[model samples]
Target: MNKDIRITFRVTPEDYERIKTKADQAHMSVSAYVRAAALRHKVVVVEGLKEQTHEFKGIGRSLNQLTILAHEGRVSVVDLDSVFSALEKNYIGLCELAEQERR
Candidate 1:
């Protein structure tokens, strides 16, 4: 989409500061943040999601290593039902959190 159009509005100093702070928190530019807000877009900022993502990456690495070991016959691969269940639970939790924030 070509966003060549521009829109301008004035706000009180306190409102400007609040909007700037929210934009910073959302890691978006002021224009983008304002545009999203004006468009009634849900801007969810879930805390610790980054850390959770990092942990998921680490789990993926460990799973990859386990797969490699199993392929080499160096280790026996057992059922991963529990692991998958936990991952799914966490995923659902995150989704619910985002939904709650949207509300």
Candidate 2:
């Protein structure tokens, strides 16, 4: 089981309005909405970043590797589109997981 802690912070007027608007659009109270957003972002960041850390540090490096490999006749092409699709799927799944974790 996971232990939990509470946090508090102050937001500027513009950010407060933005969060409130987003909450309203989702038909949730401001607190629920903020919690949801925070959970979603945190899960995606944690799950997605693990893989990225070993990918030579960033997308530019990954692209460079792909290009270098292709130029050297080491591989036929880049599979970046598929990689991106998988990453998107991971993000969505993590977001769902976050909501579940919050509940």
Candidate 3:
């Protein structure tokens, strides 16, 4: 096994406050949060993202309904345009969020 090494650094007061705030929100120690951030790890807290969660669940329900209709052989008879439109909008929103995360 390898021994862990220490990395010490300094930041401006404002930067420190920003890091501390993010660490507090992530429920991680300052060191761990900084380390993960430096490593580019995706550490998202879904509890603070209820709107995205709700949108995702709504899209999931729409997809489930479509699945049920297909399984019951009723897809051709039902008007599915609105359901598909909602799913597309939610999917685009999610894609935009993902793009923002990459930056």
State each model's CA lDDT, in order. Answer: 0.84, 0.73, 0.80
Candidate 1, residue 63: the lDDT equals 89
RMSD of each: 12.9, 10.1, 13.9
Write the residue-wise lDDT of candidate 1 on 1-103 in tens digits.
9989887889999999999999999999999898889889655678867866876787788789889999999998578897798688778877876777668
| lDDT per residue (tens digit) for residues 1-103 in model 3 | 5538988889999999999999999999999899889889755753324676697788788778888988998775667688778778877877777777667
The TM-scores, one per candidate, come to 0.48, 0.36, 0.41
Q: Which model scores highest in lDDT?
A: 1
Task: Report the candidate with higher TM-score, 2 versus 3.
Answer: 3
**What does candidate 2's lDDT look like per residue over 34-94, in tens digits?**
8788788744334544554444246557677888989999999555886687567666766
Specify the poorest-scoring 10-residue window by lDDT in model 2. Answer: 42-51
Cα lDDT for residue 1, model 3? 54
Give candidate 3's error at residue 57 in angstroms. Answer: 1.6
* Poorly placed runs, candidate 1 (over 4 Å): 1-44
